[model samples]
Target: MNKPANHDERMAKMTFGSVYPHYVIKVEKKGRSKAELHEVITWLTGFDDEKIESLINDKVTFEQFFEQANLHPNAPSIKGMICGYRIEEIDNPLTQKVRYLDKLVDELAKGRKMEKILRTE
Candidate 1:
């Protein structure tokens, strides 16, 4: 009496990995509010931008460093993390084009393969 999660095992336990390689870092917390979403995901996964400004200038909050990173739920209040890379490889966006802050950053910056950036319409 416990079987519930089924959709790809609840999306691999919240976007951790079935493959490894998902890097999407679109953080715009509306009005800034001292924005520090885990230093914008360690500066878009490249890291070492002075260690994301010395770990977000020493305040550290974006839910205590992204709650150990690797997140999911890009809707019901917005979430989409893997803030380092994994959930199936990174850096996409229909190979590159679609703009206008891109619909959900092109669905988490083009994983699920983007499919011409989700039909762009």
Candidate 2:
């Protein structure tokens, strides 16, 4: 009955705030706005602007961030590869959710329309 190894440790050690700046830079370089990035994140994780600000300011770990988030109903609609992994095929639920966000941001950075990224179209 031993717990799994450092999977949680790795995920927990990554603070969302630590990564936010990179995301901003990536999208901005491609002529996208920070507001669009925020919108995609909020849509996926169900965190509002205020809550997201608080989470970033607090340096919350990915674990805590996902724990508090009420994932959107359409999250499963997000699919495709990110960082070489097929998001929908990831077996770990937490890992899949993380990759889902990454995929969305990648799409945004690539200049995909918000409606398409959100799967609303």
Candidate 3:
């Protein structure tokens, strides 16, 4: 039987701009800087400052946002749970990408060292 649209499905349809404010709020509440959040996003998506700004200004959907992104090679190294789901194990590729971003932001908000968050050698 067909299932109802889940959060990921609904989220994919939503604009990244629409969701960005919430991310900013979440990190800011934890004392993380907006620059840090943007840094992480740029690291993961390979979106330069101008690209991200344009995407946000254009109100691109998550589906479109990721479609246009040049995901980092180490992005797969970002494995863990977020919102109760194992990001690495997510069956839907798009959902996995979205959760990967979420997990990174969560780590930043939790005060994880940037080196560890980026999984740098």
Candidate 4:
């Protein structure tokens, strides 16, 4: 499906908190733990468990969530398709960052090793 022209704008306004639960469910149903999910998130965004909880409680938008993030230096290595978009090819920086997180979560759910998912290996 074709994304709307305002896709980036719409995604920017989406609350990270609203999407957090779905991520948890997706990973957990595949036998991954919530802690593992948090690890992936931390690897990408550098937010620890406490900070993540706070962000979830505060219902921060994706834009705000990323603004405060110390994005991992290795993030650019996260290449592939997510939500029908080639993450490396995305022109908008924010959208690419969001897709990076989605790709990490997808890898985790697919049972990839943590080191590989984090690009440590």
By lDDT, the best candidate is: 4
Tell me, by TM-score, which candidate is best: 4
Q: Candidate 1: which pairs clash?
A: 21-86, 21-89, 22-86, 71-81
lDDT of 2 by residue, 23-94 (tens): 999999999998898999999988888998899999998888999989989999888777777778777788
Task: State the lDDT of candidate 1 residue by residue for 1-121, as single tens digits.
Answer: 2224453233333322211112223323232211333333332333444544554455443333344333322212222333322323223321111111123343433333333322322
In candidate 1, clashing pairs total 4
- Cα lDDT tens digits for candidate 3, 1-121: 2335696688789899988998999999999999999999999999987898899999999999999999999999998778888887787888889999999999999999989988895
Q: Indicate whether candidate 1 or candidate 2 has the larger lDDT.
A: 2
Score every model by TM-score: 0.19, 0.90, 0.91, 0.97
Error of 1 at 16 (Å): 2.1
**Regions of candidate 2 where Cα sits further than 4 Å from its true position:** 1-8
Task: Give me the overall lDDT of model 2.
Answer: 0.86
Worst 10 residues of 3 by lDDT: 1-10
Model 4 regions more than 4 Å off: none
Model 1 alpha-carbon miss at residue 89, Å: 27
Candidate 4 lDDT by residue in tens digits, 43-99:
899999999999999999999999999999999999989998988899899989899
Instruction: Report the candidate with higher TM-score, 2 versus 4.
Output: 4
Question: Which scores better on TM-score, 2 or 3?
Answer: 3
